[model samples]
Target: MSKHIVPLEYETGLAELRGDCARMAPHWVVPAKAAASPVAASLIHGVTVPPASARLIDAMSDYGD
Candidate 1:
Protein backbone atom coordinates (compact mmCIF):
# COMPACT_ATOMS: atom_id res chain seq x y z
CA MET A 1 0.00 0.00 0.00
CA SER A 2 1.15 3.48 -0.73
CA LYS A 3 1.43 5.96 2.12
CA HIS A 4 0.26 9.52 1.93
CA ILE A 5 1.57 12.09 4.44
CA VAL A 6 -0.27 15.21 5.44
CA PRO A 7 2.68 16.97 6.99
CA LEU A 8 1.46 19.12 9.87
CA GLU A 9 1.58 22.51 8.30
CA TYR A 10 -0.14 24.52 5.69
CA GLU A 11 0.74 23.51 2.10
CA THR A 12 4.00 25.44 2.51
CA GLY A 13 5.37 23.01 5.08
CA LEU A 14 4.86 20.10 2.71
CA ALA A 15 7.31 21.71 0.30
CA GLU A 16 9.70 22.74 3.08
CA LEU A 17 9.97 19.35 4.80
CA ARG A 18 10.16 17.40 1.54
CA GLY A 19 13.35 19.31 0.73
CA ASP A 20 16.56 19.43 2.77
CA CYS A 21 14.51 19.72 5.95
CA ALA A 22 13.92 15.98 5.92
CA ARG A 23 14.10 16.11 9.71
CA MET A 24 11.67 18.96 10.12
CA ALA A 25 8.67 18.86 12.45
CA PRO A 26 4.89 18.98 12.31
CA HIS A 27 2.83 21.14 14.66
CA TRP A 28 2.04 17.96 16.53
CA VAL A 29 1.79 14.21 16.13
CA VAL A 30 -1.90 13.56 16.40
CA PRO A 31 -3.60 10.41 17.52
CA ALA A 32 -5.21 8.85 14.47
CA LYS A 33 -8.61 9.04 16.11
CA ALA A 34 -8.19 12.72 16.93
CA ALA A 35 -6.49 13.55 13.67
CA ALA A 36 -9.16 11.88 11.57
CA SER A 37 -12.02 13.23 13.60
CA PRO A 38 -14.07 15.64 11.53
CA VAL A 39 -14.98 17.59 14.65
CA ALA A 40 -11.32 17.97 15.62
CA ALA A 41 -10.35 19.33 12.21
CA SER A 42 -12.76 22.18 12.74
CA LEU A 43 -11.19 22.86 16.15
CA ILE A 44 -7.55 22.72 14.96
CA HIS A 45 -5.85 22.16 18.29
CA GLY A 46 -2.15 22.89 18.80
CA VAL A 47 0.54 22.13 21.33
CA THR A 48 0.98 25.82 22.18
CA VAL A 49 2.25 28.56 19.90
CA PRO A 50 5.66 26.96 19.47
CA PRO A 51 7.30 24.01 21.11
CA ALA A 52 10.88 24.26 22.37
CA SER A 53 11.87 21.49 19.94
CA ALA A 54 9.07 20.66 17.51
CA ARG A 55 10.78 17.65 16.00
CA LEU A 56 8.64 14.53 16.28
CA ILE A 57 8.20 11.33 14.26
CA ASP A 58 4.95 9.53 13.45
CA ALA A 59 6.28 6.47 11.67
CA MET A 60 3.31 4.56 12.98
CA SER A 61 1.11 6.71 10.78
CA ASP A 62 -2.34 6.19 12.36
CA TYR A 63 -2.25 5.69 16.13
CA GLY A 64 -5.02 3.08 16.51
CA ASP A 65 -5.87 2.02 20.02
Candidate 2:
Protein backbone atom coordinates (compact mmCIF):
# COMPACT_ATOMS: atom_id res chain seq x y z
CA MET A 1 0.00 0.00 0.00
CA SER A 2 1.16 3.53 -0.69
CA LYS A 3 2.42 5.44 2.29
CA HIS A 4 -0.04 7.98 3.71
CA ILE A 5 1.01 11.58 4.17
CA VAL A 6 -0.79 12.46 7.37
CA PRO A 7 -0.73 15.72 9.25
CA LEU A 8 2.39 16.59 11.21
CA GLU A 9 0.66 15.70 14.48
CA TYR A 10 0.28 12.10 13.41
CA GLU A 11 3.74 12.11 11.95
CA THR A 12 5.16 13.39 15.21
CA GLY A 13 3.28 10.79 17.22
CA LEU A 14 4.27 7.98 14.92
CA ALA A 15 7.89 9.15 15.12
CA GLU A 16 7.78 9.16 18.88
CA LEU A 17 6.22 5.71 19.02
CA ARG A 18 8.94 4.25 16.82
CA GLY A 19 9.00 0.45 16.66
CA ASP A 20 5.98 0.20 18.89
CA CYS A 21 4.03 1.81 16.07
CA ALA A 22 4.65 -1.27 13.97
CA ARG A 23 1.72 -2.91 15.67
CA MET A 24 -0.62 -0.22 14.46
CA ALA A 25 -2.96 -1.02 11.60
CA PRO A 26 -6.04 0.35 9.91
CA HIS A 27 -9.30 -0.85 11.41
CA TRP A 28 -13.01 -0.33 10.83
CA VAL A 29 -16.21 -1.91 12.03
CA VAL A 30 -19.75 -1.67 10.72
CA PRO A 31 -22.79 -3.86 11.01
CA ALA A 32 -23.69 -6.00 8.01
CA LYS A 33 -26.88 -4.00 7.51
CA ALA A 34 -24.99 -0.75 7.79
CA ALA A 35 -22.39 -1.91 5.34
CA ALA A 36 -25.08 -2.70 2.82
CA SER A 37 -27.21 0.35 3.50
CA PRO A 38 -27.56 2.98 0.81
CA VAL A 39 -26.53 5.65 3.32
CA ALA A 40 -23.30 3.83 4.01
CA ALA A 41 -22.65 3.41 0.33
CA SER A 42 -23.30 7.08 -0.32
CA LEU A 43 -21.19 8.24 2.57
CA ILE A 44 -17.48 8.70 2.04
CA HIS A 45 -15.63 6.00 3.90
CA GLY A 46 -12.37 4.15 4.18
CA VAL A 47 -8.97 5.21 5.48
CA THR A 48 -7.35 7.58 3.02
CA VAL A 49 -4.37 8.39 5.24
CA PRO A 50 -1.13 6.54 4.68
CA PRO A 51 0.84 4.71 7.27
CA ALA A 52 4.05 6.06 8.68
CA SER A 53 7.33 5.39 6.94
CA ALA A 54 11.02 5.08 7.88
CA ARG A 55 11.60 8.72 7.01
CA LEU A 56 8.73 9.74 9.26
CA ILE A 57 10.03 7.57 12.05
CA ASP A 58 13.50 9.05 11.79
CA ALA A 59 12.13 12.57 11.66
CA MET A 60 10.00 11.96 14.73
CA SER A 61 12.98 10.62 16.63
CA ASP A 62 14.70 13.95 16.20
CA TYR A 63 11.81 15.88 17.73
CA GLY A 64 13.21 16.53 21.20
CA ASP A 65 16.87 16.25 20.30
Candidate 3:
Protein backbone atom coordinates (compact mmCIF):
# COMPACT_ATOMS: atom_id res chain seq x y z
CA MET A 1 0.00 0.00 0.00
CA SER A 2 1.19 3.47 -0.80
CA LYS A 3 1.63 6.07 1.90
CA HIS A 4 -0.72 9.00 1.72
CA ILE A 5 0.77 12.46 1.82
CA VAL A 6 -0.99 15.58 2.91
CA PRO A 7 -0.04 18.70 1.00
CA LEU A 8 2.23 21.25 2.58
CA GLU A 9 -0.38 23.98 2.46
CA TYR A 10 -2.93 21.92 4.39
CA GLU A 11 -0.35 21.01 7.00
CA THR A 12 0.66 24.63 7.38
CA GLY A 13 -2.95 25.76 7.57
CA LEU A 14 -3.70 23.10 10.18
CA ALA A 15 -0.76 24.25 12.21
CA GLU A 16 -2.05 27.78 12.06
CA LEU A 17 -5.50 26.59 13.12
CA ARG A 18 -4.03 24.70 16.07
CA GLY A 19 -1.99 27.67 17.11
CA ASP A 20 -4.92 30.03 16.89
CA CYS A 21 -7.06 27.61 18.87
CA ALA A 22 -4.41 27.35 21.55
CA ARG A 23 -4.04 31.11 21.74
CA MET A 24 -7.77 31.61 22.15
CA ALA A 25 -8.34 28.67 24.47
CA PRO A 26 -6.68 30.18 27.54
CA HIS A 27 -8.74 33.30 27.56
CA TRP A 28 -12.37 33.45 28.61
CA VAL A 29 -11.89 37.17 28.80
CA VAL A 30 -9.71 38.61 26.09
CA PRO A 31 -6.64 40.40 27.40
CA ALA A 32 -6.58 44.13 26.89
CA LYS A 33 -3.30 43.98 25.03
CA ALA A 34 -4.39 41.22 22.71
CA ALA A 35 -7.84 42.64 22.14
CA ALA A 36 -6.53 46.03 21.20
CA SER A 37 -4.08 44.95 18.52
CA PRO A 38 -5.14 45.09 14.85
CA VAL A 39 -2.75 42.22 14.13
CA ALA A 40 -4.41 40.11 16.78
CA ALA A 41 -7.82 40.89 15.34
CA SER A 42 -6.64 39.86 11.87
CA LEU A 43 -5.36 36.55 13.21
CA ILE A 44 -8.76 35.81 14.72
CA HIS A 45 -10.24 35.77 11.23
CA GLY A 46 -7.70 33.17 10.13
CA VAL A 47 -8.96 30.68 12.72
CA THR A 48 -12.07 30.18 10.65
CA VAL A 49 -10.33 30.01 7.26
CA PRO A 50 -8.77 26.58 6.91
CA PRO A 51 -7.05 25.83 3.57
CA ALA A 52 -9.24 24.66 0.76
CA SER A 53 -9.84 20.89 0.79
CA ALA A 54 -8.38 20.69 4.28
CA ARG A 55 -11.15 18.51 5.71
CA LEU A 56 -11.15 16.16 2.74
CA ILE A 57 -7.40 15.72 2.87
CA ASP A 58 -7.48 15.26 6.63
CA ALA A 59 -10.09 12.52 6.46
CA MET A 60 -8.51 10.67 3.59
CA SER A 61 -4.92 10.93 4.72
CA ASP A 62 -5.55 8.83 7.85
CA TYR A 63 -5.12 5.63 5.84
CA GLY A 64 -1.45 6.15 5.11
CA ASP A 65 0.73 3.07 5.25
Among the numbered candidates, top lDDT falls to 3
Error of 2 at 25 (Å): 4.9
lDDT comparing candidate 1 with the true structure: 0.53
Model 3, residue 59: distance off in Å is 31
TM-score of 2: 0.16
What do the candidate models score in CA lDDT, each in turn?
0.53, 0.57, 0.67
- For candidate 3, write residues 1-63 as lDDT tens digits: 999997665545778988998998878676576455355555565355377666666668574
lDDT, residue 18, candidate 1: 72
What is the per-residue lDDT of model 1 for residues 1-65, given as tens digits with 9 covering 90 to 100? 99999767556666765764556446447566645535656587765633333323233345422
Off by over 4 Å in 2: 1-16, 24-34, 39-65
Ranking by TM-score: 3, 1, 2
Cand. 2 Cα-lDDT = 0.57
Candidate 3 stretches with Cα past 4 Å from truth are 1-12, 29-65
* Top candidate when judged by TM-score against the true structure: 3
Weakest lDDT window of 10 consecutive positions for candidate 3: 34-43
